[model samples]
Target: NTTPTAVADAGDATEKGGVANGSGGVVASGNVLTNDTDPDAGDTKTVTAIKFGATSGTLGSALAGTYGSLVLNASGAYSYAVNETNAAVQALRLSTNTLSEVFSYTMRDTAGATATANLTVTIHGANDAPVLAVQTTTQNATVGSAFSFVVPTTTFTDVDSGETLAYAATAADGTALPAWLSFNATTRTFSGTPTAGGTYGVKVTATDLGGLAANETFNIAVSVPGNTTPTAVADAGDATEKGGVANGSGGAVASGNVLTNDTDPDSGDTKTVTAVVFGATSGTLGSALAGTYGSLVLNASGAYSYAVNETNAAVQALRLSTNTLSEVFSYTMRDTAGATATANLTVTIHGANDAP
Candidate 1:
């Protein structure tokens, strides 16, 4: 009843005609019959159980012949293994209880009928979460501007294509999404114009059909537009001061805010003073007083103040001596780009306040 076939190739292996390759080490046998049977032999048959990557075992019962288990390990998909005892079968003890491995069996009838076959069994692991390319990104927008952020198709990826993946967005603090923004779970995007200028932080989570999840956070900065270049009121303004009097105690001193006096159209714009210089003077005392009559300078509110002494002889000599006094000065305001805006600051001094 002994049935023999062509010799098995010990080089290349397949499931039926060769041993399929595996990750964890596994003991496989030669390719033969899936289930062998013999006519004259009784229904009784022997099965050779070769544990390729077993954790622990007595190394008993898995008999191919009286010699030993015919489990020969080689680096080939197709290979032949003969029955022999003490073949030094290696058992790489993997740490986990779940892994995929192959088990080969050789069944022989009592009448000497024999066949070999193998099957793969995988000890599955817990489902895995998809991975994202970026956990955070920052984008800029202006108030009232159309704003939108869409997650790229490649934002989340899973090795298992069989598992369906979904996306959800929420506030990073787990409270709620930004007031001005809305999240689309299907598109994985954030949309809506920002109501005001500020920073909005959001978190997005990706979940697989298996319930495995991963998340990422994003930062968005919204600003008021036209702030890059601020505009202020007229670049020019005037201030006057009476001459401090040496004649009987009559003098003129005046103060004014140069900035508030001007206009600033840019809602979020601010003006700053960069430089102040007096120009050529004219009029009766203009030459003698010139830059002296008044000063051009910046105040706390980005404005200027002018003054004069009608009583002081020097001040009076400049104006009262000639019946009139005049002087001119120049100043520069800082633009949004740190540039400068030049303008004139005029001051007039009269002899009216001079001592009789």
Candidate 2:
């Protein structure tokens, strides 16, 4: 049998022109055998196998690629679909502005004789739109401190090769930022000291040279100045010591609101517990602190609980003495206007008879 001489043709594909205003990918399809031919008498052509670089395999129809998928029909027709998010492809496109994949296909004759030939597909680049990393952001500030936020350059991206982005900020309603706030297009930052109290919204836009743009919104709430210090009242509570000697097992818990009688001179101002410090140690939010004689758990809403350790030798000695003991804790509270107050809480433990 005479071996069929298989000739292959080159193909072209574009990495651009897909979804999201061409920020995605596209498909390239053509007949790879369009310029190929078999020099055998009465021989019919058939695609039997495919090979890419060092790898060789049977190709009844399709093969996958690093940046896309490739399919080859028996008739020699082929299609290559590019993956837009492929990092390698993006890097190549950005560096050299071009990409390509080359592979060889084996053609068989009706008589079973075959030959192989190569084909290459070149991918061209094009402009794509910029996309926002985050669509919206929220922030809070008080009048006493200057407010500032910088929009990261990486916040907006253009998948197309080596593209730069420009930024701008405005009111969400397409107006100017409030007088108290100023936006710097060059720095991609919002800065200024707020002079009033209210919720404000600003829209930020990132645009590429191709006129394609992406937008993000910032919702900022600034507090009014002239804050009045809030009062943190000294609180008191009582607990009965359990009649046991085991650590953490025989303890009595005392619960109360440390801010029950606290007040803020500013009208309509609300205060919340911000921190609790016992001596030189401080407790984390939503967590408990181990005190000298027990453990104290405090919440942001001013509610607190103290567990008295009946196993403490000093606490057990109280039963023989005055039959009582006292523990004090310090906590801080902040009002809506930013004023803060610190106070103490005293918890009394009454000794009870043990069942020795």
Candidate 3:
């Protein structure tokens, strides 16, 4: 058979317009050998090889291009696809620039005679969607306090040239904006002095003129000032065994943290023992105070040590009568917001036998 002549046609396609995934768009579908000819009675020609410039490719397989891929079949059918994720391919979305690729293929006849032809694929650029850098966030506000947040315009980006973005706000559920908050679409700002304390969800969207959009969701927590005061619950100390009446040394001591049970209405506030004293709020912390039957030493951490004065008349009397005596000490706790509360710590002294 005589050598076969291969002929290819040029095709055009729009980037990302072919398939749902933009992987490839069909340029033109027709038999590659329909326009080819073979001299010798009824000698048929079939595609045997494909090449792009100096790079060789296999027939019936997909070949990668500078910004996309192409596949050619032995039957002469072919497809071209744009790589949407390719950085260079993405750059095309910035402008109306077009890119082209030339593919050459060889067709062989029955007698092993072959010829080559060229097919050109032109890819037209298209617009890309905007993307959000920060997807979700949480903000804070306070009742009767000024709260303001500005959307990060620089974080939202669109690759299209000369493309402008518009901002909008809605409830996180895509409803109307909350009544207590205000948003400026022009300035991309959120500002309001909330009258109530609650968690408000917001959705901010950045949209291009093409209606392609990107959005982020966030929450704003508003707190009521001084709504809940610090609570100081009365605490008890470990019981102590009374020392002998004749014993001149200190008896078994009792110690504990008086602020352990203390709390604040606000979960965020931390309660701390600001003062520990007897019958008053202003007392030297970490100082020892004399009680009826014992001396109590208290510290700023709400830890107090009470030592029974066994030699005292009242303490000695308790041992003789097999009785119990208790000493009460006062402490003051404060929250981070300066809310203070006072509570008492009671330590009981149990009478014990005196040894000879």
Output the better candidate (1/3) by lDDT.
Answer: 3
Clashes (backbone N, CA, C under 3 Å), per candidate, total 30, 0, 2
Q: Which pairs clash in model 3?
A: 24-81, 32-76
RMSD of each: 30.4, 14.7, 22.7
Kindly list the per-residue Cα lDDT of model 3 for residues 316-337, writing each as its tens digit.
Answer: 6555334788878776666665
Model 3 TM-score, 2 decimals: 0.54
Question: Candidate 2 lDDT, tens digit per residue, 224-309?
Answer: 66666667789988776776443323546889888889998788888777667666465664687878777788998988888877
Least accurate stretch of 10 residues (summed lDDT) in model 3? 17-26
List TM-score per model, in order.
0.37, 0.58, 0.54
lDDT of 1 by residue, 169-270 (tens): 888668788778998888777889888765566778888765766666655666566645333344433333343444544445444544554444555556
Q: Which stretches of candidate 1 lie over 4 Å from their true place?
A: 1-115, 120-126, 229-356
RMSD of 3: 22.7
Give residue 77's error in model 2 in angstroms: 1.8
Residue pairs that clash (backbone atoms under 3 angstroms), model 2: none
Q: Looking at model 2, which ten-residue stretch has the lowest summed lDDT?
A: 87-96
